[model samples]
Target chain A: MSRLTSVAGSTRAIRATHKTLSSPWATAGAIVIAALWTLPTFGLFLSSFRPAEDITTSGWWTFFAHPRVTLDNYAATLTATSGITVPQALINSLTITIPGALIPITVALLAAYALAWIDFPGRHLLFVAIFAMQIVPLQMLLVPLLRLYTGGLTVGGVAIFPGFAANSMSDGFAQVWLTHTMSALPLAIFMLHNSLSAIPTEIMEAARIDGAGHGRILRSIALPLAMPTVASYAIFQFLWVWNDLLVSTIFTTGKNAPVTKILADLAGMYGQQWHLLTAGTFLAIIVPLIVFFALQRFFVRGLLAGSTKG
Target chain B: MQAFFSWLASLPNIVQVPLVIAAFLVVVAVIIVLIEVAPRPGTAYTWVRAAIAIGFPVIALAVFGLEAGAAWVFGLGAVLGGGLFWLDARSTKGRGRLIQLALFVSPALLLLIVGLVYPTIKTIVAAFMDKTGNQFIGLDNFVWVFSAGGNGGLISLINTVVWVVVAPVAATGVGLIYALWVDRSRAEKLLKVLVFMPMSISLVGGSIIWKFFYDYRQGNQIGLLNQIVAWFGGEPVNWLQHYPLNMFLLIVILVWSQTGFAMVILSAAIKGVPVELVEAAQIDGASSARRFRHIIIPSIRPTIIVVWVTISITSLKVYDVIAVITAGQNSTSVLGYEMVRQFSLMPPQSGHSAALALLIFILVIPFIAYNARTLKRGN
Candidate 1:
């Protein structure tokens, strides 16, 4: 009887709150804001489908007056003979993004496990250092890191390390993959550490008492429990690397550039090619858009876990 | 082996992608398995570990095909692996913990040291050096940065300040309002997705979308903004060519993309507010506005600060939107793009670039500190 009353009381509270929150003014305000936020992208999406001449001649909103559509823009952009085509750049993006997400997650997971479960000296200090490193702007590291990549490390007229020579496409890929892995480590370790440390101590202690080593416990118990966090972070990193423009532009050259860099170049150089630009931009956006809508729950959860852990 | 690798590389991207990913995963898996099994208490396991540690580097040497750096790789790997094995062998029951910690943490530490830490120090040193990064010419680059002249360093610095100040406040305010207005409303999820969709697309893609919106043609008014102007019988202005207006226009793109982030985070924080407090306030005849002002805002203040600081840091590092829209022309350059431009100039002004970079870092420090403080307080 008490349980039923509690359920009824909770529903009453929810209804009351909803009534108070959903006044006409608020509803109207939300609709306006949502429209404002969405219209530009919607217009762009509409234009991407319209015929090239129509897009060049009229505003996308004018589609109502003269509705026409074609896939020729996508075809043209994907098969353009002049520069790096959209398809090649798309492949490059995939190649860069996959290992870019995987390697960092692997490295960060191991470090997070050690920092969370292992009773080591200076662990707190190390964690704090890595946490602080998150604030180091990528600009600070870019010049020196690039120089190191092309010119190597030298001190007192002695070469401490030989720099990477990007003589081939694979070598270039390796350079980008390593750079992304490095830059992503601090935040990845911090977020994973937060979740790993939150696993209850009783379970860990029980496993330890059962003669399970750290690796066994981590692989069997902690990993399965923390899989959701890992998956969320993976999606976050995947989208980030996929959508990144600056790093790829700096690290890659010519045909090796990712889709974002190519799209940016197209927008810059071929500003008059509206149809091609629109199609290419949409193509670049399609993958992350799918990932965003599909894994949105995990993405938002990861954002919250990373930031609002306090 | 060379023939095999060349064949692998020659495969189409569809096949090469999985092949490379599979190879990477296999290597990582092997390392993990080796680490897991190294602790087994047996002579055979010890012998196996020793052999793998010594043999793996040799295999790497053979696979990579001897080059100038071959000796460096082989020597470094052999020493690192052999040293790690020696430590593992020496450690008995309780002492193995430190070695285990080292084994797990070394990859991340080594990468951070090489990629972030060392580069940071090198950048600081380069800031004090000449354009070629050879001679020490102290503070000249910094002076140039603050100097009032045609270099536009002061202009970029002031623009960065304006961006950092205006963008975050506008985005956070708009996001907070949207979050409040849409709270528990029907179609909440769809409404949220509309506002949040911008966060998924690349900044370059967002820039293209907005660039089309701001596009100016002489006759027909292809752009939406100009179309509205034309409807009102006004001249279609060249929006991006105007000086201060152009900067704000570029900022609009940042706000457009980042408002989604602010909204999502602040929305979550709003949901986290205690319902009982809100209900009690409502029962006390507090108006919705009053309840929001008193109850809701205070509850999510920490989150508000976090979102604000996070966006501020992002604003300070704003590059892609400006790079895509204006290419930093018309005096719209901020520190982020300026650093890149300086570094990529004809002669490559390394000192100025490094100084600009260090300046961005210094600008970011306080926001991070404030964020950490609020996080501690929230906890």
Candidate 2:
């Protein structure tokens, strides 16, 4: 009887505190805002399935009243023609993304280890130089890179950079991967170095006293401890590479083009073709959306890392 | 050495590819042998180490091939990683630390030089050079960019200025209000996720979704916006067909995509505010609004700046949104979109395009510097 009375008293206190936060006005305001944010995507996702004529004649909201769905739009978009097929573009995206994600993370890890632990000459200057490189907009590099690929950069008719990739389309996959990896290096190094530097100096000292070399110390200690930071970056880089359109569009061609490029082209060419556009847009996002949800926590941390101060 | 590499590079790619790989492998083998035999960083071998470090890239570039640039980056990582294992076999107290730093840092440095630093200088030079780039044109490109007609660079500049002003404030405003609303609520996670879903969606996907919402028709409106207008007994409007208005609409798409980013960061900032301070204010008879203004805003000011500069930088280089929706048509163009368009033309306007690229870079510098300074203080 006494225990029950105490529980009731605590419940009353909890309600009293909670009531201050659960105001009717604030809850209703949040609901309205969330609805506004979500409804646009919700409406279009509904539109993607409606019959072509119905989508053009009626708002997607009306579909809630009179239901309809179909897969024809997806089938047509997926079916290969002279242009890109979904299968091929997915392959291209993987081809670009795998190398794009792996190369940078692997390279950044080592560079980060150097920057974080090893006391060396010019470390401060070098780290600053790399970090400063992040501000250079990639658009600045596209024209010269394209020239270097197509015409072999020349100065006074002397071949300064002999165009190495003889076939434009053949080398597009490699070009896309290399450029993404390059652009990612500065931030990757910075973030991963932050994670590496966070390890306790005493732990490192203990490892050194035990005769652990830099490589063993990194492999055993830093890598294991910094796994979360690594996973955060890996997911971030994977999604960026997968969703990337600009680098892929500029550097790649034919079969090498990512899905976003084809969809963007379809959008321009068939602007009024709602049937194709809605289906194609969803198709392009499904992979990323899945990846985003599966790794939501890591993705959030990764996205917010540099946006907030340490 | 140049002639030797040029001759080696001229061989059939099949032969050249294998030769390059074999040669790289042999060098690795030799480096390992040298490290084991001569494990000291303080000897005459220091010059030999430095020479090899410098010589590797030159040989890789001159003899290996450009296709191998990706492989070179990949192999460089492997070599350094492997070197770390080899270097670890030595004693701990030696200045072998310097050698390890050089080994690890050099590959990434080489890539930065090739990828970012060189291209930046090239683009700047291209800005001053003529369309053919045979002679210096001396501000012709800049004049073209600031001129009022064609894919009017002045128009893009104005639109960009508008975007920079509007997108960040609007996004931050919406974000701040939403952050305050859901600050410690039970539904905070769900509500925040609902808004932030758009951040994960590609800018193109968001544009397409919004495009449907803005989809125009002369008949019974299909788009939600037009439907709302029509239900109110008004004419269905082409939202993106109008100038200045279309630019704002583009800004709306950016805000929609970015507001969640702002909200997430700001909400975290708000959560960091001490509960004792807020309670103290309340006990001292501060209203909700005043409590927020005096306590919360001042606490998260750095975060607000960070979010502002980030979105501003994004707005200045805004491309994918404009590309997906209007393709920079009908006064919705930005500098980035125009740069892409100019570069892709038959007679590619490399000069003017490079100039536009440089303009975006110049705009980004101040924001980045400000961010770096503030971050330094924050840390």
Candidate 3:
């Protein structure tokens, strides 16, 4: 239903646009490029369905003539007896993703609100500091963090981080959530602040006069006004967490690994086994693709949020 | 607290459900009281505010449980903030604003410091230290990074340069051309999504999908490229095993993933081009290509630069696709993959890894500065 409306919307928008784009040359170019772009995924999708034996001997295009298919690859991949199973990894993805996406947005929203609405000391410096941290390479953080997580950080011979995995965080899932949330905070706060600051000050000031403090004003006026931005950033965070492999790989192993980590494990470790990989790849991407399709508008908005200068 | 965590963890779905609800009620009640009943600053209720602010979180963390700690950690600010507000309501101390903002932003700021800033400093310091990071070796790691013999760091650096130069220009070109071709066309939405869908997939997924295309068999060709080569009366080749061609093949994967981003941003910019300008060019008897050059291209130049720089940064950090496909074999390593590879060894090459990571950081600063400047002007 949404797809139909989007299609109709685009057609209407096309009519409003310069008709030169509908020229035969442009149309042909679009078709050719679109086909070239899509053919690889389509080929893989088709190969994923063919019998395991057929995948080794034939290209996906040949499957059209042979017309053999099976769900065995999916079954086999899902039912892996060792390492991380697909079902287990899928659950792992959710465990990390839900909290990872939620915690950052929750914390960032409050911070962004304070930055935008409150005339606080050092607020300007704080905003700049937070925003500037976005460019710090993830690599720089990984070694020290992994060291701290496992070996514990010591300064003058006293461990501060305690190597949490030695105790409570044995699952490794907690580390994934914590790292993802931390990594996402700067962008979330930056984007949310942009949207929050755009809201007219009068609305917030009016709430203050009505005897509403920061908490009440935030809950009632600011949050509702920032809903679209919140949705946008939430989708962004969701996709970032979903698609991440590096952070997941650094922190997780065994049963705790997320979808990308497991898929990467198969692709990288197994290397040449196409049947399970083709199937596993599809299974891994299905959620993110669904998310992208369902929340396409918000995703784009968030991607472009605060992207334009000044 | 340990027992509390175990109890919380061990509770089954059936029992934990109502427990969570009961816990939620308690938290909500505490929050309401903090909001509704806390007295103003400099009043009789100041001590109560300080106690709740300081004492509750300590209790929450030390005595109650992990679950309660998490809940109270969130309220730690609001509860303590309530007291701070009451005590400094008149701003006589001029610290109310500072305390209020600090409470609100403390969680995010603390996480950033721990997660990003401190580690960044540590990594920089590690770059100057030896592999064990216990002794200061100074400039040796950096010299090794630029040296040809040290872990092929120089090879990785050159390959990264090639990627930044080729991938961004190629991807942005494809994206710009697609955005121009599909703009306002009937199939625009579907076509854009087709180009865009690859992006939603992880880089590893893309590498595997494309790996099949480059997959070579000795006897009867199974891979698409091999089949095409064999059909055209040529021998099937191992695509990624080839030298310069392998780099291009890997770079193509980056382009495939990034083209959609470029297209979307450029398409938006193209759409913003005033129809009057195009119409005016048309009325003046200008050809479509001429109009595109004279009007549309000029209009979206900012978007073009953005897409280019965006893809450039992506290229500099191009690790996952290379990791999945080539594993830096055949001299296909970029800076990011090499850094990870260096760091992942048994004892780990701490200095080399940190140096490579810092190299990437330094390389990215100029692009970011340029982008930030242009974005300001565009706005």
Instruction: Identify the leading candidate in terms of lDDT.
Output: 1
Off by over 4 Å in 1: A1-16, A154-160, A166-171, B1-12, B42-95
Across residues A1-310, which tens digit of lDDT does each residue of candidate 2 receive?
Answer: 2322343355444334335645567767887989988988888788889998888888888887999998777787778332777656766676667768877887788788889998765878988988899899989888777766556655455454555454243343445656887899998999998889889999999998997777667778999998988998998898888877788778877655777777777778778888877877788788888988899988777766656634
Off by over 4 Å in 3: A1-17, A153-159, A167-169, B1-42, B56-90, B93-98
Fnat by candidate, in order = 0.58, 0.50, 0.52
For candidate 1, what is the lDDT?
0.83
Instruction: Evaluate all candidate structures by whole-model CA lDDT and list the values in order.
Output: 0.83, 0.76, 0.77
Q: Give the per-residue lDDT of model 1 (tens digit) for B177-248.
A: 998888767877899999999999989999999999999998887898999999999999999999899999
- Ranked candidates (lDDT, high to low): 1, 3, 2
DockQ, structure candidate 3 = 0.45
What 10-residue stretch in candidate 2 chain A is worst by lDDT? A1-10
Per-prediction DockQ comes to 0.48, 0.38, 0.45
Clashes of 3: 6
For candidate 3 chain B, which ten residues in a row score worst on lDDT?
B60-69
Tens-digit lDDT track of model 3 for A1-310: 2322343455444456556546878879888999988888898899889998898877788887889989999999877633868877877777667767877887788789888887756779988888888788787788888876666555445443345445334454546766887888888898889878878878877887888866677778888988988997888788778888778767876767787878777877776678888898898889989999999987776666545431
Error of 2 at A27 (Å): 2.0
Q: Which ten residues in a row have the lowest lDDT in candidate 1 chain A?
A: A1-10
